[model samples]
Target: MSISFKKLIEPDSDLASVISQWENDPSIIPLTRPNQNQEELDHREEVTVEELMKRMEHHQIYLIYLDDQLVGEMNYMVDPSHLYKKETGTAWIGITIGEPVGRGKGVGYKAIQFLENEIKKQGLNRIELGVFEFNQTAHKLYSKMGYKEIGRIDQFTYWQGKMWTDIRMEKYFGSANNN
Candidate 1:
């Protein structure tokens, strides 16, 4: 399954629907955040298409496609308050595979690899991400992709009658590309 990305520009109905579904998907949300019930998720603040467009002005957001079919989305930004203070070209990234068919198919790995190359070309030296402790799948994937655990936030989230930490992982440009 070949993976590719296109910069997210204007929001369309299809994309909006996909985002809404992903936001409300219990299975998907737990992978990124504390496991919350549908009611709580429904009441959370929603990002309108206009808000997303505004965010695009300052971030690199892309739509992930597999064989020309939209499968997910990924985004990154240089954090002004990053520990490296942007001097080392430190950037944080997030990704979501909205389509169930795209999960566990190496689509995310390919997409991240592609985006890493793009970031390298742009002179970024480090890429980082935060994964919930319960997200073992993502932890394994990131480790396989050469990201090392740099830190963690204690009790970052509460869910399922327990507290979960957030694992911070990072990979530097020119490091071993294990994938």
Candidate 2:
């Protein structure tokens, strides 16, 4: 299976809708974003396509494709100098294999590898991400990808019935490139 990433077009309602759906997906929401508070729950703002289009302004979004099938989405904050100059930079990133077709098939693993290589070539020296304490699978994936835990928040997010911690992890390019 050939995996690829295509840059998402700006203000793409169709694609944005798909991404919105993923963000709200039961399987993905807890893993990617579990910090919503009780008050926010009552007034929870949905990730509408319009809101996603607005976010696309500052965040670089990419659609992860497994051959011809769209399986997930990944994103990172845009760094203007990271791509144009050889300046060292650190970028936090997110990935979600929202589609069932991509889960349990190593798509997230491969997607991270591809994005890391792409950013390394663009002058980024470090990458960081936060994994919820309850998500052991993601913690393991990040660990196996050479991301070392740097810190943690004791009571980071309230999900399910209680609060869970968030572990911060980072990987420097020197070792990451060799992964």
Question: Pairs clashing in candidate 1?
Answer: none
In terms of lDDT, the poorest run of 10 residues in model 2 is 78-87
* Model 1 misplaced regions, further than 4 Å: 34-45, 80-88, 175-179
| Candidate 1 TM-score, true structure as reference | 0.85
Clashing pairs in 2: none
- What is the C-alpha lDDT profile of model 1 across 13-75, one tens digit per residue? 667777767776767776655534445433544556876777787688889988888888888
lDDT of 2 by residue, 1-179 (tens): 87888877764667767776777676677777756565432333456677877778877778898877999988876444423222347777889998898887888998898778777877778787889999998899999989888778777777777788889887877754433
> How far off is residue 77 in model 1, in Å?
0.8
- Top lDDT hit: 1
RMSD per model, one decimal: 3.5, 4.7
Total clashes for model 2: 0
Write down the worst ten-residue block by lDDT for model 1: 35-44
